[model samples]
Target: MTLVGRTAAIGTLDEVLAECFAGVSRTVLIEGPAGCGKSVLVDTVVERAAAAGATVLCAVASPAEQDVPLGVIRQLVHGDPSLALPEDALAAPGVPSRVQDTQSFCAALREAGRAAPVVLCVDDVRFADDASLA
Candidate 1:
């Protein structure tokens, strides 16, 4: 479907995309109430990034898994089983914790970015686990 009434969002995302392509670090957080086309808007951006030859990694948070630490990160990392985590990467504790896992995820993301322009997209972040979101 054609994206309608999202010229501003699209323009903003285009700027971020341009920065990413230019080897500049950037982050864009899109938030809105449910059924307000947030997902659609982000999906459009993802498509644009891919079409521009960037490697796009995406994770969609699930309400049922919100209590699972690193659940969202795990989804992104494991989206392609070939993506390897470092041997020194710390595992998530039995209890939900943020720092170690997020650090590992970020490191892995940095490594992936070395191969190509990496666009990390997290959808439904409002439903992401506290540790992951924090």
Candidate 2:
């Protein structure tokens, strides 16, 4: 693997991102320590996905505000105002507590993926809320 900077393993990430875009799994999770280049890998994957005509959604877990509900999902839908939530899904009982407002955003993501594969990157998992992690 070629190191892009002092930390990022660019070459390895590039290969993985390529496979991700090729519809290998549709979901790619890159986990590592704070300074271990996970964000760098996500960035590389986003770039490659864009180049391949895929939509990219990204969310970062913040250490200072890990309790925020649907923080990651909010970030993913912020720019795409047209995205809609599923009707009444949020009001359903026994729905996973961790995934709030799930109907709309989840449906929006599924719709986006139908048009073209979407690369959703969730970084800083260690700082993510336990509910969100579930």
lDDT of each: 0.77, 0.63
Per-candidate TM-scores read 0.81, 0.68
lDDT of 2: 0.63
For residue 127, model 2's alpha carbon misses the true position, in angstroms, by 1.7
lDDT of candidate model 1 versus the reference: 0.77
Candidate 1 Cα misplacement greater than 4 A, ranges: 81-101
Q: Where does the lowest 10-residue lDDT sum fall in candidate 1?
A: 84-93
Residue pairs with backbone atoms closer than 3 Å in model 2 (clashes): 85-104, 86-103, 86-104
Q: What TM-score does model 2 achieve against the real structure?
A: 0.68
Encode model 1's per-residue lDDT on 1-134: one tens digit a residue: 58889888899899988888888999788887779999999899889999998888889999998878767766776656445344333264346654655666677778778866888789988888776676
Model 2, 63-85: lDDT tens digits are: 87576654555566566765643
